[model samples]
Target chain A: MSTVAGSHFWGPVFALWQRDMIRFLRQKNRIIGALGAPLVFWVLIGSGVGPGFRLPGWPADMTYLAYFFPGTVVLILLFTAVFSTISVIEDRREGFLQGVLVAPVAPEAIVLGKLLGGTTLAVGQALLFCLAAPLAGVPLDAAVLARLLPALFVVGFALTGLGFLVAWPLESTQVFPAIMNVLIMPLWLLSGALFPAAADSWMRYAVAVNPVAYGTAAVRRAFYGDGASMGLVPGYGPALAVSVVFAAVMFALSVWMVRRRRGTV
Target chain B: MTVYPVETDRLRRVFGARVALDDVSFAVREGEVFGLLGPNGGGKTTLFRILSTMLAPSGGAARICSHDVEREAPAVRSCLGVVFQSPSLDPHLTVAENLRYGGNLYGLRGAPLEARMRETAEALRVADRWSERVKTLSGGLQRRVEIAKSLLPRPRVLLMDEPSTGLDPVARVDLWSIIGQLRAESAMTVVLTTHLMDEAARCDRAAILHQGKLLACDTPEALCGMIGADVLTLTGREPDRLAGRVQAEFGWAASVHDGAVRVEVPRAHEQVARIVEAFPGEILAVTAGRPTLEDVFVRLTGERLGEPFFEKAGGRRKRR
Candidate 1:
């Protein structure tokens, strides 16, 4: 077992992850599709929704575009995560995932490599979407970008891990799109992506419980200073703690599922 | 020199309520082409999956070069290569890129990786089309590239699941030639699963499996010998009635199944001539043939190989 562990733990993981990156790079259309849709949403939706939308605790003068920029970033990350998860089904159907499963690599590495590869792609999309924030009238600062980097990484990692966990039990590709549809919208809405968490007491409670809500809130705080707080609900310290915990839990579950499914191919 | 490159003992696998493989066992001597011959859904792929370390056995164990498939899978994997029944190459990548990526997976890099890629491509006759995208390559060429990718690591055992499924006759011959060369030159143990009779005939030894059971395992000649005679197939307008009449009149051992009458006779050619002469109106076609892997499979399973099962909704037999 140790010999098996040593031989496969790193080599195939790195190789598969690198291959995935290369695949993403080669498909320029997919990158554009992932980044472009969210940019359009941020611009069109933010502008359209900006005039009438105002949160209770948010500064009265804050424009809808500035208020929603952080949410859009989170939305972009969520979209990328969901899409990347759905691609696992495609990979499985294409036989590449099966090839990896049959290789000497450890199951943990398969899960980790897939998550890392997917997280990298998701983060790339998020960063590209972030580039549009300035032009959309959202303020940009070096500190915000620097602070959001680790938060985005954490969120991407968490989402990728969650994606793998969802993908493991699925037997057919047909179920993935439907599952994503059921999952993505609820997770997005409940995460306070469209409105501030402090708007409603119940919503603040719900956001506190939602894993994605913590990630979005953390990202929003990074972007707009303390103005993005959840009021008396929970501080950034607890939210960061919850996000990290959620990531760890999801990652552990994903790894376990991969190991269980490893040789049953 | 008396090494068994691949070995398994009572290997079994269960999926849900179905027993996919049951107490399967075999060994492949170095430099020999070992064939797992079974009908579709007969546990051939399941066996290959376990041997390739893609599936864990529910019972028993297997080893490649003395490394346990379950415990020492990485070491076992390093010493083996597999061509899955499904196309395993990345369709988006160029053939050269796919091969290079495979090489990289096994830790080959720099000059050695490049040299190995060139050698494999040339040997597999895919060198000229190395730069073409895999999706653009013909099915046969894609299979060759897959085989080449497997050969890159110089593995001790090469496990292929139905490797000749989509190849044309000429391509099949080419692939067989490559297998022969690989076995002869590299002394690698080549294990492949195929339901195709001719392909099974090419193997040094073959195992016939049915419904997750290993019915028989031996040299192709020995398997044919077990049936004791050549096969005489008679297709007639009324095959069932004719088969019964022929059986009653000549006291010949025969069976009517799959729209054909199968007779085992000492000299099938002479018997076929006599049957054709006697039953002129009834017989549409009379052909004498040697006992093939299909015959061996039928004899073992009590069912015709590749016959469509009418029992279930998704019962269509997959082609090899």
Candidate 2:
């Protein structure tokens, strides 16, 4: 059977991916750290902005708490994604990844497995964050749940792939906090997660080029339903298309990095 | 089938201006316990990495079962099982879980994978520790589980990098006995790298590496036979001065090494008493014994195995 031979490729991918999942579940601090901080940020900053404050493109009735809800969800996903991918640096430093690198699996399978593992963690955290939507005055109905989950998954995959690329060449996790400060914080800030982008603001231009912007916009569209969006963000069709393309490209980049010259590692 | 389970043809690897492996070529016959013996930074790890398909050679090629390590990595990987110097098992995972994961990487699953895991665990004497997390196990026990995990795939060849590293003497003995038992039971072809002279002596055949070059490759006894009949070791604080005096006065070529003066002679027992009598208080202790693997390394490379080269600052100490 072709499947029998093909399992050589996918089998290792599944094993590596499953190993990450098991490690994530076993570590209690990871779960708390991944979910706890974003929840705190959402509550503190959301209420601090007050309900009456409105952006140029926000719906009149939407509170600052409601506006910050989807951004906090994206924050959870980013934290979990970074946390999961950081294990790659650990794997290399501790010699675990060398075992996988020597296996019969293709490099593409390795990249896909790690991306999926990180996506699984990110999406899990995102789901937990989603439960608090009502606190932000957003609905938790089936219609919202259905659209929000898929959009989060796509965003998770893209973000995790991006994280994998960043983490692959790094030999230590000590530099991650600095990297997160310089790269990750800016990515979320410009993605229209904290504030709505206006047509004339420079942020609108930055949002247009940011993949996370499309991801956050997709979630916002899902949260508000048809005709409820600020009209400042890209349409649902374009956001989803751009995000999927971003994910595919980031995945391909990760695969290339792994398959690069043998000496770099 | 290839005559050699492992073979390399002029394999070379370079890190910028430094060459890690330089024109190293050798072969390990099927079912043989082969050792790559070298000091730290002597290119054993580079060669191991190339054979295990982790690092591509900068020039020439290495093959496992006639498949090039670089061009046919998957095929080469399927035949080789590698146990690294550092711990590779996830500390959070149980022995059983680690074995299961290893089997899955080789495409084994379900009952067959479980059976192999149990078989290997029982053989390595880690079956009782299967449910314990790896972090809870001692270094020796973790290494046993690591060996068990690699065996789950039933690879034709096993390559271990510094297998006895960080093990107590008792644990080191236990590890070697396990390797002997595994080879006898399964006819496994085992290749291991080590810096310990005693460890290299246990191999059926061994290769000596120094500064990225192959010094010699032969059976342990054969390599030792390259040295003279006996080795006389003199331990003292001023070994370099003592060695120079021994060479100048006694006309014997003595070398200072590892805080000791070593001289290879035809009859060390006869020479040791004369040396002690001649030097008096200059020599702290003197011992004479048959030649071993370290003697062979010193004979070939003019330096003892595993000694730090830069620490030979005896010349400067005297001037000061």
**Candidate closest to the true structure, highest DockQ:** 2
- Model 2: CA > 4 A from native: A1-7, A55-58, A261-265, B235-251, B272-284, B310-320
A40-154 in candidate 2: lDDT tens per residue?
Answer: 9988998998856966655788898898898888899889988899999888876778888776767778898899999999998899888888877887899888888788888
CAPRI verdict (incorrect, acceptable, medium, high) for model 1: acceptable
Per-model clash counts, in order, read 1, 0
Model 1 has how many clashing residue pairs? Answer: 1
Clashing residue pairs found in predicted model 1: A263-B55
Q: Clash number for model 2? A: 0
Best TM-score among the predictions, by candidate number: 2
Candidate 1: list runs displaced more than 4 Å. Answer: A1-6, A49-57, A135-137, A171-173, A226-238, B1-3, B268-285, B307-314, B317-320
Worst 10 residues of 2 chain B by lDDT: B311-320
Per-residue lDDT of B1-320 in model 2, one digit per residue for the tens? 55788999999999899898999999999999999998877788888888987788899888887888888777888788889887788888889998898888788888989998998899999999989999899999989988988888888999999999889888999999998997788878999999898999999999999889998999999998888579999997799999999999988888877789988889889987798889889989999999999888888888877546424422211200
Cα lDDT for residue B31, candidate 1: 84
lDDT for B178 in candidate 2 is 90
